[model samples]
Target: MAEQIELHEQAPRLKSVSSPQDQDKGTSQQDDVDDTGITEASLTLEEQTDLDARRGQGFEAYPDGGVAAWLQVLYCFCIMFTTLGGVYSWGIFQDALHAEQLAPSSTLAFIGSTQATLEGLCAIPISALVARFGNKNVAVVGAILSGLGPILASWCTKSVAGLFVTEGFMFGAGQALCFFCAATLPSSYFSRRRNFATGLVYAGSGVGGAALSLAANGLIKSIGLPWTFRILGILFLAINLPCAYLLKPRPIISPIHHGAQGGLTWGPVVKISLLKDIRFVLVLIGSAVALFPLFVPPFFLPLFATSIGLSSGAASSLLAGFNLASATGRIGWGVMADRWFGSLNSLLLCLAANATSTLVIWPIAGRVGPLAVFAVINGFCAGGFFSLIPGVVSSLFSDDDLPVAFSMIVSLWAPGDFLGAPIAGYLLQAFGGPDSGYEAYRPAIFYAGGLGVFSALMVFGARVKEGGSWRRRL
Candidate 1:
């Protein structure tokens, strides 16, 4: 009776688009836990309403495996391919910049770090905009900025400071908005196959990195760096805009938990109360720490390869191999998460293994063979961090809170992402820079592995908190 009354009251704000039969079917579907093992029953009544309203019809079931649903995955692939794909291939640019003696390795690293940092830093407001104006609108704006930033950066390639604003700040902001949408929207479309679908979406980064790494290297060889930036800017605009447009998410109304924004209220766009939840807090911290090591190898692999006597072309191939391995791991880990291990459990294993690969495999890998092995191992395990996080976030929150919750969680990643590569660069520079030989890179490698270990421990705690025992699938 209370639910019915609440539904009536909500009618003005959330008009039901489904017929009575459709609503009844949706209600039944909502009552049961899905294959991902998440249930609406666990949510508060308000949260439940918010979830229902977000479905557009206030009760529509997920499309699951329909054309519309799969197309979203494809769209997200393109977005990540053009945006994060390029971000992952930052080594190509860094290598070129290093050759030119533009600045210290640390300073050059800061350019990429700035872009990575903003991916987390700007997420809160962008997510709030997602909640308020809808996902498509925010993503469209991101598409524009994603392109514009690079186009602008082409003119500023001569100045590191200018690159900071264009490539670092602007590009990072655009990636954040686009990534949030890509990462979160597929969950709205899938229940049983949520992990797998998200894995497919994130795999775009690996595939894009693999392809674009080679492409960027080739472009740089053929044309000058400035022209390369111009071509990439045009590429970003052409691809990201269409994908952003075609990527339709379920309609999201004002989130009551955050309170509706009125005339210029200056609080966090999505005021998350999840901070009070210890499990969420732990997961948040773990995810942030995980970021500390996630990009280190990608950013430095080419330089590291060069130190070990590989040519520039070979270094590019190694980076591409790492990305390709990561792509495979994204899909493979997602399947494992769905079939055998739970998302949290899978994430725990991945982080631990990722750390082990970095700590154990990397230090001993002085030759091409060992280094190549480490790259593959590290890339595969590292991919799990990106793939399973959506599933983990989905497990913790109701659908209505997902966009904000995920954004808020990742926003904390700004510090880790911002510092990870720069710290590595500084470590290398402190030990005598990249010219100081392969031994100079160990400190940074240890730093990255240590952060991964810390992240794994945090994840373990969160998992224990969730299931009360390590034996459970949760």
Candidate 2:
């Protein structure tokens, strides 16, 4: 039911004046807070008009910064810690599967790639489910699948195909459900501090990844892989089930926020007209291309360390350190996005830095000292991608259009995430099998780095489309 409230006897009208540059770009700056008490700097003239029309309609205002909002952030952090944090720790399992000779390197890469791909691809349908069923209900399903998949996978360790179904498809599906629901909510909860809040949310992945990677290594050594998975399953259930219960989506009139009463209808799944916008198209392409090289390092870094004669424990430690640095990067980038460089600008800078580090550092880092340095720099740079994307999408679209726009951006990440590491694995095998020297890995590194460069260029193009001035905080 819509809340009924009395309006002030003499309600003040919010106003904004467009500058010449804003006129050229077609965006308006809200000089005064809206009825919701939020100042939206990126609102288009049409969006501003829509909000004005909604005033005095008895809609609840955005809490923006309150206990309820921060609690949601905390819940989202725990969700990411279990979902993507586990995915980021795939290097530990990759090394183990390789040792067991369970499958070819390319095939082994698929197990990780499949889960990662599904996380991206499944977001489209999950968004619909969230719209109809509500965030909490959908998140409950996610928690179940995420916990159940690994538990079942423990029984299917002998067959590579079995791992695909349990670990890859099932776990991937769960991640999509939980991750997308949590990721999309921050935009609704906060406007001024959205970037910073989102940064803190995503930083969970790095922290979880770092912690779980170390834990998995110890568990694998102490008991075994199967037992380690069972323990992880119990942990996922305990953490996520409670978080799912606490998911209190802000009451909104939009279809996606309709929860159970929304009736099987999807409001704006993709907004087909957005395909025609050059800015949207450019950012979409860049987002897709960026992932082409994103997983290459995380998937192979442990193997690379071992190839250079580091002990297994030492190699795993490097990955853990890398993830810790990634956590720092997420927070740092988020602050930068909110305080200094705007989201789009931050994304472009991060991608460029990510590509540079991969190209210049990895190939020459044959020893422990250099490899450790590469991990920290590259991990921090790569971490920015997760923290900045939502802000960039929000900047380009209206609040009503956010669900569809952000869905499209994440959905496109599937192709690159699915294929990047497998291609690298295939290249490694083609050049020479495991018996071959580290030279076998060079082609894969170059391929990943080259794609990173291309992704940065595409983002640069998007930045140009937005207005190429470096002085402007895009």
Clashes of 1: 0
**In order, what is each prediction's RMSD in angstroms?**
6.9, 7.7
Model 1 pairs whose backbones collide: none
Q: Residues 98-165, candidate 1, lDDT per residue (tens digit)? A: 78888765677777777777778887877777766667888998899889988898888778888888
User: Candidate 2: lDDT over CA atoms?
Assistant: 0.78
Q: Which stretches of candidate 2 lie over 4 Å from their true place?
A: 1-62, 97-101, 251-264, 433-435
Itemize residue pairs with steric clashes in candidate 2: none
TM-score of each: 0.84, 0.84
